[model samples]
Target chain A: MSLLRLALANLFASWLTSVVNVLLLALGTASIAILLLANAQLSSALSRNAAGIDLVIGAKGSPLQLVLAGVYHADVPPGNISSAEIERWQGHPRIASAIPLSLGDSFRGFRVIGTVPAFASLYDAQIADGRIWRRPFEAVIGSRMAAVTGLAVGDSFAGVHGLSDDGERHEESRYQIVGVFESTNTVLDGLIVTSTESVWLMHSRHAAESAPHQDGVASHDHEAVQHDHEAKAHAHEAKQQERDQGQLHNSVIRHGDDITLLLIEFSSPIAALTLPREINAETNLQAASPPYEITRLLQIVGVGLNWLNAFAGSLVIGAALSIFAALYASLRARRHDLAVMRCLGATRGELFNLLFVEGLLLTIAGIGVGLAFAHGGIELLSVWWGKGQAISVSGWIWAESEYVLVFGLLLAGAVAAMLPAWQAYSADVARTLSAP
Target chain B: MTAEKNRVLQVEDLEFHYDQPLINIAKFDVARHECVGLIGPSGCGKTTFIHLIAGLLQPIRGHIQINGVDLSQLSERETDRLRGRYMGVVFQRLHLIPSVSVIDNLLLAQRFSRTKVDRSYAVNLLEELGIAALKEKKPSQLSQGQAQRVAIARSLAHRPALVVADEPTSALDDGNAADAMRLMRTLTAHADAGLVIVTHDQRVRREVDRVVNLGDVA
Candidate 1:
């Protein structure tokens, strides 16, 4: 009925070539879209989780690992620092708030963080059920942890000694589940929180039980011959008393001193410039800036993503070339048909527009299919990775760059069809119409 | 005087050249409902003469007036528009877009001519041509005779004042050629339009009312 309809009909008549062009373009567009969505989500998740906390102070080791362990909880902590050292910096004039974290235990793959109530407030997490931990052995679980482990109020579970589930279990220290925190859509949602005293209690009891035993002789009220045995027993008792005193000393040291890292915020911007330097210079602790370390991590990841984007871009160019080749070749075969149209009184411009419309229709359909593929890919990624890390991958996230990409693809299609359309417009109608 | 006013085409001092002169016609004219045949040997510019009259080629020197409007004075776009509205061409090769159905091909003619498509009129025309049942069939599916009939139906779909057939029956057998010529002449007369058949087919030459030899004119 119309030129557009005629164009559509012709495309469908050559459905195989059209489908191949659309699929190639769709695949390229989907890959670029997936990359953009994933990169944006990764950057935002990193920034959101690292909010409020400006610096992390831990044992001198890999600064990146320290940030990863202390802030993101994605890796093992560098090492432990003494609580006395943390307390010494806690009251500094430049410090706004400092919360000490004691790590090294887990419940069902989720890290059990030993910190105070302020840690929960750092993530804006509230008690969704019951209450926060009120005692040394009571635990408050994160929303994700609670849902995954099915641990509710008044439930009790034993903690494993390390970050992984296969670590040694402390059967003696059973922690009662006191509360569950609401989902913060951050790393906080995958944590089991308790007081630092609880971690100290569990490890100290294990240490005391594993201590070396002193040899002893049994004494009886016999005679002077049993005096040697009595002397050995008295000696053993003295050794035992010394061992108990040493154990008490060790318990006191462990209970008051050990913590994994310090999550710190500055009262003023001046502290950011001075505190990390001062702490690293004056003390054995290593000061790591979360923002600097996270930026470095993303820069490293961005290189690989850039390569993938370039690959997808090349694929788009290839698809455009294919479209051009197909249309140009088809034009050669349809010369007589074009001539017939001319004889029917179609102008050169109308013939050119028909090809242009055909190319545009293919590109638009391909883009639509490609967008659907991108959203489906993101949804799959959310299910596979987001749940474990408490990252939300839901919602439509359209980027301005994608609009630019759509325009570029449409332009590419137009350019591809330009030559063939021109040929169709300038076809020698008289010669073609007279051909046998 | 009324008959002179009904003249569909008039040509005077028409001369066209491509490398050399292909056509030099002193005078030609066709009145309404008139049927004329243009006969020529092979390579004698029979098709070239048709192209010149159809506004597809500009004459080196000529005045071609269709319905008394001089084509040489019109712009290229206006000439195309005039041709779309006032002229129909049936090519030697019977060119129908192989992708579309017969009815759509006819509709396409109206579309290109910027005229309102009357489906019932197309159906009536096809039925009169005895190929109404093949309206939905693609050109490739139709027989050669059916394809040629479809081409004729498309050309006349907009009811042009003049229908030009360039070797319309050259590919047919003797019997089929005579039938095609008869059908084209009858259809053009029924539509109240003049017909011009440029061909070397003797059977077609006998079917028209008048014959002009291109070799003699050149």
Candidate 2:
């Protein structure tokens, strides 16, 4: 008989066991694939966000934490840094533009950051509807936040006290949604952006209620409302006048010198070198170069994660070895079959081919099944993740390296079958035929 | 036997062993169209001697020539070629390839022999062996006698020069064994192949041209 036919017969002789082995290998491969894919995407997002800014000036804390929380939206900021201290660095020749950030709130597990109009513009954030926030308490929702929370323009939602799902609620300081930002495949997908004044207003309201301080403050009742309305009207007129005059300084700073983090951009690369260190040593604040901090963090975490991947890879190798052992053990049971072929004048090389064909069949079946499983799983994850982001990937996410991995696995199978093939080759034809 | 005509198999000083040596036949030969019946008690080397002659085992002190080629000095590939070209085998237990259809079992001889298969001949042999309807059936689906007949058909399909039957009737009833032996001897003589059957059963011994008791030779 042809060696291929013989191999097929042997593989199917224990059909259930062969199927189970393929399934096991596929599961292990798919698990590693999903983990690696997620890690690659997350790392890419972090580096992409870090690419836009030169330095992050914030309250002195872990620079890595600040970069992660501020740029990538992965974690919380280290601590609140005073905007008053940040404002001093704004007009310096070394600093081109100093954008402020105010954090410490969330809407349904998504962080709410209060930033200037420049924040949206710098990030190229487009609005699906309505305009930017022009007053305190007005907010803009991210595409992912809106999709998940179902919050639209003119809807009001209260900010929770923490980043987690079970954080306390600040129901008293509910924010108004004035705009919805279009989908951008960045951290904005899971963030809430508004004016810095809105965050300061929320915190100030809490402070005023607790302390009941009135000295040097505007009237708290009807007169305060009336005066604030007049101030807003005057500010609007001043903006129109500045537009006509061709000088853009009429924009009002409602909460001056108060921000949690500052995203800075310098006019030149040389400014980045001296400006960050100067800011760190000259002021009580700390400045972090996002790219550097991110790379360092990646190096540290990447080393640990890569080590884990290697360990997982070795486990997969162990699975392959077990498969080899199982196939080899089956050779003894198949000796009689081999003998029949031998007496028919089947060559030793053909006998070896029979075993190799069996191994190839197992490897291909395992990879095929595993790929299907991984595709289905990745689709499910995409549905869940797309509810919070705009990134999409294909079902058959075959990379150049993945094919190499599969080839390597198939080669290992061949190597595993070699021993049994050699045994079959060296088997005594007469002895087996003579063996009852 | 004639000096050089129709001689299919020859052996000289053929020596074989198990854990301990026993029968040591000095000379053995079979010509084409001849039927040789080998009779011996249990553990008397009937099976071992057939195995050595089939090139399945190497005799320590002699040579085996099948179709005029020395099997002892041949490489594995050469021996396999020699076996496929000149010899067919039917064992006591009927070693039919279990996973394949009966026809495939017959075709296996052709495939490994690397020869053009005669499907009609295989079918005709199966019909003569009383398993014509079982061509597509697996060995597991066959009765013991039916399986044994199929094994014989497989051996003769390639039209080899020598056919070795190692206890082909061991598991059969008296009538079935007699029928099997008569059918095999008639098929071998018709194909002009030398038939060498190893069996201890005296009931089927009378059908062959000659019967040699291995115990008498030893």
Candidate 3:
């Protein structure tokens, strides 16, 4: 048998030892893989969601926190900017659209985002299932919220108090789920979307409870008119009057002049470049170009990842050292075997060959098994998490970095085995042979 | 005969020690094509002498030359090369490699040795040693006699100038030991190599050209 085959056979003979060695390597590599994969996806998602928007005008705060809260809808908006103040910028010469955001509530940790239809357009969001919100108090749900809440078209539900369950209640204003949006694979998927007026009205209900449940009555009347065609003629004029009363109260309380953030799109590159500095100086508000801010965020995260990767690499080196020890320890036990081979005219190099081959074979086998296990684990995680969402979780395991990790782990194993191979080469054949 | 052609091993003023003081030897030599038996009781330095001859242990004060190359003057690399190319060994325990098959054990001999092997000759040697059928078996699978035959076959696989079989028949039964001795002698004779078999077994003492007893040496 060839030295490699012989070494492999030896490794196979001690199945438990080899498995433990391989498993350690696999665990170390896989943990590193998951950390890297998750970070890359986070970075990718950030860049993808921030693609169309040129700049964000938000209340002065941490720029990264603002991006997380404003564009992603993943966190609470930093603070409110007067909607009236935002409206002044809506029709500016350089402005394309000013999407105002109103946020104060959540459904099961998912933020309920109150915004105009420009919110959808800004992220290239489409309604793959039903339609976008057209009326106040009628909500269009994001893909993840739709899947998690199991809310279909026309299903009505009330939002929980605040982002958490313990916040003060808004019992006066209940919402009807008008549509379920398709998966966008963006942070928008983790939200409930409604018009800015509806969000204000919900808060208004909290402020003035006894003020003639105006919008609630209008929506109830609208639903009733849908069932009976004969009542349609009678209800049409009544519905209009109710709608007018609802709007009059909402406008009086409509803090739409105060917005948490403004996602700005520009028709020209020059306008986009000059707008941030102009807005930053013009008012107390801050403007951030998302791509630049995101790049900076990634740089901070990248340093952490490099240190983590080095840690993982060092653990792998430790595993290699363990393999070296296992082989070295096995050498004395194999002395009789060596001596016999020497008597048969086996040279020192051949003895070394046997040991080296054994080390390499053990490493290769462990790496192969570990990589396969890691790949399968990643695939399983993706499939489980991908249910009812546009976000593909399977991309993590198949990424370029995963391939590099596998190659790197195998290389480390080879280098580990070389030390003991040299020791076996210079072994004292006569003494070892005669040892009892 | 040419000066290089007749000499297999030459030793002069060989001395060695363990925890004790040194035992000096004035001169000793073995010619090519000779089978010499080193007979001595326990702790009498026969194995130590063979170790020196095999280039495994160096003498405190002497030189050992195998074929024409003086091992004392050789570097570790050259010593290793000489050992690989010119010497073969059979331990008292017949230290057969346990992991490989008997055939692979034979093949391993060529890995370090300078001598080119003939597989057919190896097969013939195994056949002569009555281990041809057991060539694919591991050392652990063979009987003591069979394993020793494999060891002898391995030593002769490279056709080295000297074969030092230390206490070669020590572990075998009387019948098996006799068989081992006869087989080793026949094989080394056919290979035309010098054979130094170190053992205290007086039963097989008559088969060698000369019996040097370490008990009577000093």
Number of the top TM-score candidate: 1
Candidate 2, A53-153: lDDT as tens digits:
88888878788877876777766776666656555668778787888887777777788887878787766889998877776667888888888888899
Query: Candidate 1 chain A: worst 10 consecutive residues by lDDT?
Result: A218-227
A1-436, model 3: which lDDT tens digit per residue? Answer: 3566667767766668777887777667766776667766666777778867878888787777677667765555556677775556777889887777766777666777778776776667888777776667778888787777777888877776556865554555678887877777787777788877666555544433422444222111012111111222233334434753553222222322344678887867898668888988888888878888778877887898889878877777777888888888787667667655554445677777788777777677666666666667767877787654434566334556767877776677767777777777877766775556
Best-fitting candidate, scored by DockQ: 1
Candidate 1 backbone collisions, by pair: A83-A257
Poorest 10 consecutive residues by lDDT, candidate 1 chain B: B209-218
| Worst ten in a row by lDDT for model 2 chain B | B1-10
lDDT of 2 by residue, B95-172 (tens): 898878899888889877777877888899998888899999989999998998999999998988999998888799
- Candidate 2 predicts chain B with a TM-score of 0.94
Q: Which ten residues in a row have the lowest lDDT in candidate 3 chain A?
A: A220-229
Question: What are the lDDT figures for the candidates, one per model?
Answer: 0.82, 0.75, 0.71
True-vs-predicted CA distance for residue B40, candidate 2, Å: 4.0
Where is model 3 more than 4 Å wrong at Cα?
A52-54, A58-66, A75-212, A215-261, A265-325, A336-368, A389-391, A395-435, B2-6, B12-33, B60-63, B114-124, B214-218
Q: Every model's Cα RMSD, please?
A: 8.3, 6.0, 7.9
True contacts kept of each: 0.71, 0.80, 0.40
In DockQ, how does model 1 score against the reference complex?
0.65
- Quick one: ranking by lDDT, best first? 1, 2, 3
Of the candidates numbered 1 and 2, which has the greater TM-score value? Answer: 1
